[model samples]
Target: MFATTDNGLSGTGKPESVFISWLLWQPRGADLAVEALKEVQKLSRYDDSDPDITRLRSLFVSLAGADGPLH
Candidate 1:
């Protein structure tokens, strides 16, 4: 059996595990990042009344075109 929380996959006794999983699963492109961010923004609780939400939306859209640099 497993216990779950608001963030999902809870009760593992390893908080950082979720972050590691996310980092490993993340896509490797600016366009994908932009699209993901946009989806997140849409699902987030922040509405138009929130300044931060608007700023983040603008930033994601602005970066939607760049392919990002090779590391």
Candidate 2:
């Protein structure tokens, strides 16, 4: 949902690759969130001190909407 736009995309090389990847994953966002959460849960067993984890959680919550996923 983020890495590209209808107007046009910028950057090159790595950024280009990442943008394409984001576009590909946009349709699987919810599944991505669930998998990310599952990964965090697994990592929590060892260490969950990464701030990136928090950011990932927040991004999913925002995407899920203020009320979150239905049911």
Candidate 3:
């Protein structure tokens, strides 16, 4: 699992492993993952109007589960 605060992010071992399993492999570190997630959030309008955004959001939702994103 992972968490976020005003300072930044922190995660247990498993959280990074999820990113490692992906072919694209993004979660290099807490700082980078947080930056990347921020970028993804910014790009996604969250209105379900864009398939790409919807898919990305869905991926994160699935990865994060009920706990939601790192925050």
TM-score of each: 0.35, 0.32, 0.33
* lDDT by residue (tens digit), candidate 3, 8-70: 222222333433455255544545444456545654555656444455555554444425543
Q: What's the distance in Å from true for residue 48, model 2?
A: 4.5
Query: What is the C-alpha lDDT profile of model 2 across 1-49, one tens digit per residue?
Result: 5573432322222433433464476664357555544544543454335
Root-mean-square deviation of every model: 9.5, 10.3, 14.2
RMSD after Cα superposition, model 3: 14.2
User: 7 in model 3: Cα distance from truth in Å?
Assistant: 38
Which segments of candidate 3 are over 4 A away from where they belong? Answer: 1-44, 67-71
Candidate 1 vs candidate 2: which has greater TM-score?
A: 1
Error of 1 at 70 (Å): 28
Query: How close to the true structure is residue 29 of candidate 1, measured as C-alpha lDDT?
Result: 59
The deviation in Å at residue 5 for candidate 2 is 26
Question: In lDDT terms, how accurate is model 1?
Answer: 0.46
